[model samples]
Target: MSNVYIVEDDPVIAGAVADHLATWQMQSRCAKDFEHILEEVEEYQPDIILLDIKLPYYNGFYWCMEIRKTSKVPIIFISSADDNMNIVMAMNIGADDFISKPFDLQVLTAKIQAVLRRSYGTALSIHKLECGKVELNLDTTTASVDGSQMELTKNEFLILKTLMEHAGSVVSRETIMERLWGNDEFVDDNTLTVNMTRIRRKMEAAGVKDFIVTKRGLGYIVGE
Candidate 1:
C-alpha cells in the first residue's frame, strides 16, 4: 500500500481527499500537527504529500523546502491559492504537481494514482509495506514520505521495514537478529533494543506517534 500525507488545514476538504485515496485502496493520513509538519512527514513517510499553500505557523513553501532537504519524494500542491504566483512558487519549491480547488475527486484520484505509479513502479505492490505517511521503497532500500527521503541505517531500515511489511503481525526478536546476520552482523538483545530505540526516535522526530507497538515477549508489530 502507498501512504499519502495531507497538509491541508480545512477539515472538510482534507477528509474528502483522504476518503478518495482510501476508496482507491491507498492508505492516507491528514496532518495532525501543523507546527510539526516535518515530524508528521517523517512519521508517515508518505509516498506523496498533498500540501496546501496556506498553512499554520508557516506556508506550504517553507515545509516543502524542509522536506526537499532530506527527500526526493513526490509532492502535489492542493489549495485554493491557485493564483499564478502561488502555483509558480509551489512548483519552484519542488512540488511534483498542482491540483487547484473545486476540482473533481475522480480527477484528483487519477492524478494521485499516476504519481504513485510513476514514483513506485506500480500502483499496488504486495511485497511492500506501508505505515504512517511513509513508504518503504522495498526495491530501492529507501524510505519516502511526502516527497521527502530519509537515509535509514541498514539495520534501522530492515527492522522497521520488516514490521511494516507485516503490519498487525508480531515479528520476533530472534527472527530480527537472524535477518541481521545476512549483513554479517550478530545482534544481541540489547543491540536490537538500541536499534529499535534509535529508529523510534527518528520516527518520533518526524511527527509520528505510537507507530511501532511492542508485543511484550512476542516482539514488535506495526499497529493497524
Candidate 2:
C-alpha cells in the first residue's frame, strides 16, 4: 500500500482519482489547505505525490520546488495545463511524470505504478503494507500504528510482513518460520515464539493492543 498525496484542487477530479487509486490498493490523500502543501506532505510522508499546476494561492511549480528542497518523494503532475512549456517546466522542476486532463484512469494508474517502480526501485514498488491502522514501511523496516512508529528488527519485520501480506487470514507458524529462515527444518520453532512476543510488546508500547491475534491451533492473524 503506497501512500499518494494528491495536490489537485478540483474536488471532483480529486475524488475520482482517490477512488480509482483505492482499487489498486494504493492509499491517497487529497490536499485541502493549498496554502500549506509542504506541511501536509511532511506530515503524510507519502510514497508519491500527484500535483496539479493551477492551484489557489500558489501553483504546482512553487510547491514542487518547495518539496524538492527537503524530500525526494516522487511527484507526478496531473493537470489540464498540458502544453509543451508546462510539461518541460514540470520535468525541469523534478516532476517524475505528467498526465494531461481527460486521461484514462487505467492509464493514470499504470503511469503511477511505473513512476513508483522507477522512484523506489523495482524491488520496492510495494513500499508499504497496511492493515487497519497499522502500516509497515518495507523500505524502512518500521511499523506504525495510529501514527506511532517503532523500529523493527530484521526478524520482526519479516514476520510482520508475512502476516500483514495475508492480513485477513491466519498464517501457520511453520509457514512463518519458513519465511524467516527460508527453511523450517533447521530453525528453532521457539525462535518464532520469542519474536512474536517481542512484536506484541512493541505493539503495546506503541499503543496497539492484540494487533496480532492467536487462533489457538491456527497460527496468527492481523486485522482480523
Candidate 3:
C-alpha cells in the first residue's frame, strides 16, 4: 500500500482526507509536529505528501524545498491560496500538483492518483512482484510466467496486486472490495468472485499454476 503524508495543520480537513483515503486502501498520516516536519518526513518515508501553503513557523514552499533536497517523492500543494503566482511558485519549487482550498474530496483523490501514476509507474506503484516463476510488472500491468505473458484487466490486476502485497496473509474480502471500489457502496460480492476467477484463468494461461490460493471463509493469498 502507498503511504500519503498530510502536512495540513487543519484537523478537520486532514482527518476527512485521511478517512477517505483509507477506503481506497491507501495509508495516510496527518502531520502533528510542525516543529519537526523534516524529521516526520524522514521517519514516515511517505510515497507522497500533501502540503499546505500557510503553515506555522515554515511555509509549505520551504518544506517542499527541504524535502526535494533529499527525496524525489511527489509533493502536492493543498491550500486556500489559489492565485496563479502561488500555483506557479509551487510548481517551480518542486510540487507535483496543487489543489485549491475547499476542493472536492473526489478531485483531491483524482489529483493524488494522477501525481502518483506520473511519479511512480502505472496501476501498481511498485515495479514488480514475484512469486516462484511468476512475475507481475506493475508498469505494464501484465503477468509473466515461464517466458509466457498475459495482459490483465484493471480489476484483475488490482486483485492480483492486493494478494501479492499481503503474500502469506489472508486478505479479507471486505478489504479487497474497499480497495477496488473505494466508497462506491454498491458493489456486489459476485463481482469480486468473477474477477478472481478471471485472474486465475489468466495466470494459468500464462503458464503459472496455483498462483493464487483461496482460503475457505477468508480472502486470497499469493505466496505459500
Best by the lDDT measure: 2
**How far is each candidate from the true structure, as Cα RMSD in Å?**
16.8, 13.6, 5.2
Q: Which stretches of candidate 2 lie over 4 Å from their true place?
A: 126-224
Candidate numbers sorted by lDDT from highest down: 2, 3, 1
Q: Highest TM-score: which candidate?
A: 3
lDDT of 3 by residue, 122-213 (tens): 65454677778877776466778876888888688778777887888899998888878877778888999999998888877776778889
TM-score rank order: 3, 2, 1
For model 1, residues 68-157, the per-residue Cα lDDT tens digits are 999988999998889999989989989989999978976887787677767777545433457768677654456666657676886887
lDDT of each: 0.79, 0.89, 0.85
TM-score pick, better of 2 and 3? 3
lDDT (tens digit, per residue) of candidate 2 on 55-142: 9999999999999999999999999989999999999999999999989986888888888888878654657889988899765568
Q: Give each model a TM-score.
A: 0.55, 0.57, 0.63
Better of 1 and 2 by lDDT: 2
